[model samples]
Target chain A: MRVRLRRQATLLATVAGLLLAATPVAQAYEPVNIVHTEKVQAGPYPITVGFSTWPLRAIQSLDFTFAPDGGIEGKSGTLTMTPATRSTESRKRPLVRHPRKLEVWGLDIRALEEQGDWTFRFRLDGPEGPGEGALTLTALEPPGPPMALNWSLSTLPLIGLVAFLAIAWRRTRAEVLAG
Target chain B: MDLTAPGAHGVRAAATPRTAARGMPTAMALLAGSVLGLVGLTWDVQWHTDVGPDTFFTLPHLFIYAGSALSGLAALVAVLGATAAARAGRPLDPTVGGASVGVFGRTFTAPVGYLISGVGAAVFLLYGMWDLWWHGVYGFDAVIDSPPHIGLLLSGIVTMVGTIMVFAAAAEHRWGRVGTDVSIALTAANVTITVLGLTDVGGPVDAVHTAMAWLVVILLLTAAGFRPTRGGAVIMAGWLAVIQAVTWWFSPWAAYAYADAVGLPVRDYINGVPVMPALMPMALIAVALLIEPILKAARAHGNRWLPVAAGAVAGALVAALQGIQDSIVYTYPTPGPGTLLPTAVAGALLGALAGHLGWRFGHMLRLVNRTRPEGN
Candidate 1:
């Protein structure tokens, strides 16, 4: 009878262990899935650029991750972006940790203002040496209706307000004159 | 101000006075809300500069929305109270301190000021959906001049104007006039700071900004001069300075503490001084000094162009003041004859128009006291 009881306990333990082992590890944050990646050679240092959203759309927010061949250590970098049209000034800033994905340098929920092929220039300083490279990313037109159409729809409130105010004014005046 | 009376169920009320003092709390609430909104804006600028845009529901945004919500809530309370009071056969104008607007063909009456405030609040809140769509299309804005952002800020200014009207109705009271002065100052600072895109270190746009900003200062000053209170415009200018001083301290501290609390590290690069430490036209006292005497002369002699002259001089000086501020703060090319000449030419036109407009608004405010304008 004792042997049977021991056997039952062992069976329960084995089943629990199997279930625990089969289950995936808990995610500490909302996981950022890198949908597409591009390779750029910054001299001696080979870097990988990952985008959370594939078929990048202009003005659409997406997470970007930049990782070297190995882990990021004893390294710093700056990112400069020139728009596709190149009509505006290029934006330059230091590369910082993605607000959500803290382990690597990234831009979280950033978007390209203009559509077409935008250039991203990266200057990296690392333990191995200094390296620089450029990547041209194609940002398709923004999703949904044209922005002009959206603006036309959005401005309906203003028109409604004007009409309402006019009505309110006239009605109030009529009542006052009657009095 | 017993707003808790189970409403009159939509009865029409008279536009007569009940108790002038009862509306004080509501006026105070309006002022506090507008000021809080300004405070939040200052913090927001710092947040954007110190930290990157991570999400929409950041702390600074909450402050801003909360402040606007407070203003909207106050306006709603006033409108409903007045409506209920009117339905109960109580007079509406005294409660609203102005004329009453008949709602639903006089089913409900709303005060002009409170109603305007309510409309502005509704627009601001509703505009958020449009702004959200804009973000979806445009992503995070690299600059503050996004179309939706401009709309949102403009609506808030409308609310600020409503706040001024709320006080303007009760301007007969000493405290009421003081309230008017403070609200005007806040509105001016808000316009100048938020519209900094209109003015920058250099370019022709600065001229445009200078002209508009000059007109705003002159208009508000001229309007305040018509108030019954002595030194009203000067007091407004002093309040502007006070806002500057407070913002210089509050902005940095709020950003640091909030970022620390949230465990979000700030960016390494930041502006040397508080973002908009004293972006307002600080030479307002000088303008007020000239304006008061000019206003007095106009009243005694009825010289119409005196206002134009006052506005023109104030405008030129305003342009000069801006140039000086730029030279001191930024290494932007000093405004030579090239910049100053065109700016002054544009300033004169806008300034003159503002002066005329300011007179009408001020005189209207004076008449609201139910007394002779000159007597006030």
Candidate 2:
């Protein structure tokens, strides 16, 4: 009888263990973040872009503007942008330029939406390196939407159920004694 | 019949007070829950190839696995502690003999607590689901990202199985208790799934989190030899607070410093990926763990320093972990200003509220007796 009791206890534990061991996914479904920034002390500042998220899909928008250090001479410059997929690293996209100060408020280059080999090259026409490379652009297509699989709210009903059992069990024991 | 046996009546009567003391587990559960809330929020982790061989070998995977393991360890600790403590006091009444049988004709020899564990497992899973939705899926914009996709699936399975166990255990307890092997099997299956489901091997930091969790479990079990009730709860809470606080502070600092050293931006924004808010939750977890033990100990001992000490430990850990974790990331890409601050603030506030509410609700209620008539 003792052995049987021990076995039963073990079974109960096994079940609980299995429940916990199951893979637990997150509730949120936010997009991956991989943008970096640099503040230049001189006139133009340099900015490097980093991308993460396998199976490159698409970028909806890329917008940038110039913020002068001390004086604002209607900051105008000839700029270039290039993109290369992962596969063909050397097949670089040429620098597509705009003559005016602020070109393309929001550029959506849909052509770069191919499968393989992707990288973007940027060069702003200004003084050499230091403060001459200031640029800010928004990369679009932040993942699909946040997922709903949070544990806290999901477990509220369970809390209620546990309470019910505890109460019921306590009562049963009480009755067995009273009887 | 044995109620009249030599010394049997004395033993059975003694069981009454201890049985009454069974009420203490409920309080411990509340305390553990609060601690879970705290650590779950405050712990921070980062994955990188830049660390030294020693750190590279240890920390990362620990944080990832800590969540699932903690729940199971907590339940096991509760069971073993209660059973052993009761045994030390007086021989249990043989009247509650044989395994607790359920309505469905199931039978098991383990103490009634085994059956009660189903309730705890269900609560754990449900909490995971809510967390996934609020923080994991909907809260973050990285659903399509590589690693989170794995997180989504793993957390989902845990939640589903946990729910099933809840109902199954309830049915077992209410009807006829299932054998102990069934419970163990349930746990084994869950662990297997998590192990198999993990896509990333995880990094060094994750390993640290896992080790800490393992240590916490061992400490909890060891504490059973002491006061059982008080010791178990305190150790569990303290362990959780320490682990989470350390993790919270470690990640960003590593990221920030690495960025400065490597000459990369403090923060990085991948094209489709969203910057993560992993740190805020770490702070929250630290605060919650701090409050649980303090409140429980305070209510019991009525000592001022107990609460203060708990708070100080929790706060310091949160700050320390935050510092360690942020140093690397703060300088990497520069957190778009005010990005992580809000999460930390929100997590702290929520942790405090949860701590107070959990204590009140858990301890305030008087156990209701609703036993059915005999031979019904």
**lDDT (0 to 1) per candidate:** 0.67, 0.32
Per-residue alpha-carbon lDDT of candidate 2 for residues B27-135, written as tens digits (9 for 90 to 100):
2332233233223322222322122111111222233334434444544554354345344654443212211223222211222333334334444454445434433
Residue B110 shift from truth in candidate 2, angstroms: 11
Measured by TM-score, the strongest candidate is: 1
Sorted into a CAPRI-style docking class, model 2 comes out as incorrect
Tens digits of per-residue lDDT, candidate 1, A22-107, equal 53342132356899999988877788999988889987777799887876777888888897677774767887776666678787
User: What is candidate 2's CA lDDT for residue B347?
Assistant: 30
Worst-scoring 10-residue span by lDDT in model 2 chain B: B367-376
lDDT of 1 by residue, B166-281 (tens): 77777656556777778888887787765564643556435544655564655464455456445666777788889988998998888777666666666644554566654667
lDDT of candidate 1 at residue A156, scale 0 to 100: 53
**RMSD in Å for model 2:** 16.7
Provide the RMSD of all predictions against the true structure, rounded to 1 decimal: 13.0, 16.7
lDDT of 2 by residue, A67-86 (tens): 33432333333333333323
